[model samples]
Target: MEQTQSLVLVITTVETASDAGVLSRALVGLSLAACVQIDGPITSHYRWAGEVQQSSEFRLMIKSSLSAWPELRDQIAKLHPYDEPEIIMTFIDDSSEGYRNWVIDQTT
Candidate 1:
């Protein structure tokens, strides 16, 4: 049996909502992502440069196909502000049929 390709949700955080909007637009415009949802001014606590740090950040949930992953990663690397931006990918194991089809149609 052949393995099936599924959608992925790419998550990242930025300092401001404006950055989220900019990055989201670029991703969609370039066909790198089908949809991008921005959420938060949520609190983040993490270690950076060996120092513990805390900050408010906006999170971006980007929806795209697995095939687009590489270019999407590259694009985020180019556009993200943090020296080491939080770019994480999670495979979407299941979703509504309509929504899944929409994602596939939206992304190349």
Candidate 2:
């Protein structure tokens, strides 16, 4: 039996809502992502270039297909304002039938 590809969750954080909106719109507009959910004003604490850093950020959780990874990544890199943007990815083993099918349909 062949395995079916499921939906994927791509998470990233940006410094501002405008940045989040820009990325969201660009990804969806370019068909790189089926949908992008923005939520936050969360505080992030991390180390950057050997220094401790802290900041308030908004998060974007993008829904896309596994097959769309390469194009999505490239598009985010080209369009993201950050020199090193946070791009975290997790494969969703399962999801709602309606949502999963909707994601595939939108991307297609």
By TM-score, the best candidate is 1
lDDT of 2 by residue, 1-108 (tens): 112356789988889999999889999998879999999999999999999999999999999988777788888888888899878888888888888878877775
Where does model 2 exceed 4 Å of error?
1-4
Model 2 has how many clashing residue pairs?
0
Q: List the residue pairs that clash in candidate 1.
A: none
Lowest lDDT 10-residue stretch of candidate 1: 1-10
Candidate 1 residues lying further than 4 Å off, grouped into runs, are: 1-5
lDDT of 1 at 67: 80
Best by lDDT: 1
lDDT of 1 by residue, 29-68 (tens): 9998999999999999998889999999999999998888
Q: Relative to the true structure, how large is the alpha-carbon lDDT of every model?
A: 0.89, 0.86
